[model samples]
Target: MRPDDLHRYITERMRMSHVYQPVMLRELLKSDGEATVEQIAKALLSHDRSQVEYYEIRTKNMVGKVLTNNGVAAPVKDGNRIVGYRLTGFGDVDAEVRDRLIAECEEKIADYIERRGGNIWQHRFNAKGYVPGSVRYAVFKRAKYRCELCGASAEDVALHVDHIIPRNRGGQDDLSNFQALCITCNTNKRDQDDADFRGVADSYGHREAGCIFCEVPADRVIAENELCYAIRDGFPVTPLHTLVIPKRHVSDYFDLFQPELNAIRRMLDELRSSIQDEEPNVSGFNVGVNAGASAGQTIFHCHLHLIPRRDGDVPNPRGGVRGVIPAKQSY
Candidate 1:
């Protein structure tokens, strides 16, 4: 039979009878903690009481048979009553079964919701006035079909029109604060908070240069080209990392203009290229701009990190900027 036919047959068989009771029992063990025979029987009662009893007896008999066949010692006993059964070593069958049942439950719930005029996709936070087709097309054109983060141009990989500053934290809904990001980078930035520019300045031993990005000397001057800046004497993860600033700082990526955006991009490309020339075997790079404190952006000045990643770098290089600081310390 064809694979689809086999799949259909198996599904039909599963739905027909209490054959899947053992699988359910395993799932119960994993989720509801250790189960007594009574608990197991109660679960199987949903199928059929007679079937449940049969399976319970079958299960115990099968276990005993397996133990005897494997030449394992019999289960312990307390004066003619079997105390407990323990297997040698371990197996995670219960976990596997539980995951399958949970997935089935989720699918059923999703189907029920769909039937009731509720959309599963509707729960996702869609930006107001964003047409998915237009946004996707614009991002593709703007980034030239390449990942704005890594410069990868594979069409199979869907690109994201990401907000440089997240909308939840007062970021304006505009194209200037948008960027074309790859799946990896986009996933990484989710829920990240904008970096605190004031705190960063304090850390870097620089007086609040009054909106350093736009050269606004003191007073929160709301102006275009407002950038944030940061200094890294010795960057924790990457060496010699310094971030450029934009003064009239907006937290979203869609709020940047051509001139300011071009300048930052050029600087990063030049930096990466120069580093590659210096170190022949530099495998990859990590360029990040945190729009919020949660995302690990310490300075609010629209600053971007040019981190050079090499082979045998730090173990498990996940968490991007957050990985730089100890868990207890705030960035």
Candidate 2:
């Protein structure tokens, strides 16, 4: 791409596009041919590199993509751990083009401030970085220092910084998009926020066990695992009523294996925020399991209910699950 086109892609799309990779590339080349992604990101974004701190996965991804696309930087992977990248080839940034790119970023920032109304200039102006430290702390706290995926506390597992909506899914690295995950779950969810969700509906079309859960398309699935999946309840009792069902066609919840139960529980926690994003008024929940025909188990397939509770779905909110038995619902 032309130098001007590359600069436009970075400034116009950096917040939203993986195409900004080349902008990050220029900074990597400016380093003695190689540097940490953060190093490259900071050099590209800030006037003073010391003020540069851990900002967004957005930056690292752009840098990595640029390097990977150009076939110039090779990652130093230690088993599951990716240590860093080393520059192997040089399709570098010349001084003239580099100056031109910086100038373009400044102009865009000024234009953005004029169009929108925010003192976001701290960000708009070659922001040392877009995300501030305050936001990161808030994201961690909002997740209650727990793995937002498996509900494991930081004490139980190492914590992680993650994007609730991944970049591959066209998500920005903004505060609302941030989330916390334990190391293991984060590793499983890595890079999946985008492509995997899109492919889910079509990937297992042949696994039809003749039941709704088994044959249901992947798009209907809110979350899933190797053994089972979760979906919005077809006929919702509440706004975000959901069902977690095993891929197996077993009729009773008692028949669910330990792993399937574990997968359902994990997905329940992960899907909560996603539900609330659609309907913010959710105040509580009603989790239920109806076992047999006498208990009004109509579907015959084992499915766990994840019904969201609102302030007043009915006139009387008394007796909770006992309401299923009517007269027994009282005393």
Query: Per-residue lDDT of 1-331 in model 2, one digit per residue for the tens?
Result: 6668767866785664332466566676577556897887665566422133222343355667677778878777789766677767536979998799789989998898898866654533424334567876776787788887799886655565665545555444555456777655665566444455334323323344566666778788767765567887766666667777777677788976433564566667777777777788887677777788788677677777777766766744564542222211110
- The count of residue-pair clashes in candidate 1 stands at 38
In angstroms, the error of model 1 at 105 is 3.5
The runs of at least 3 residues in candidate 1 whose Cα sits more than 4 Å from the true structure, single-residue gaps closed, are 1-120, 123-136, 191-331
Model 2 steric clash total: 1
RMSD (CA, Å), each prediction? 20.4, 16.8
Candidate 1 weakest ten by summed lDDT:
220-229
Best by TM-score: 2
Q: What does the lDDT read for residue 207 in candidate 2?
A: 46
Residues 109-153 of candidate 1 have per-residue lDDT tens digits of 888887876354452335452636775676577689877878866
* Candidate 2 lDDT (Cα, 0 to 1): 0.63
Alpha-carbon lDDT, every model:
0.55, 0.63
TM-score of each: 0.30, 0.35
lDDT of 1 at 92: 58
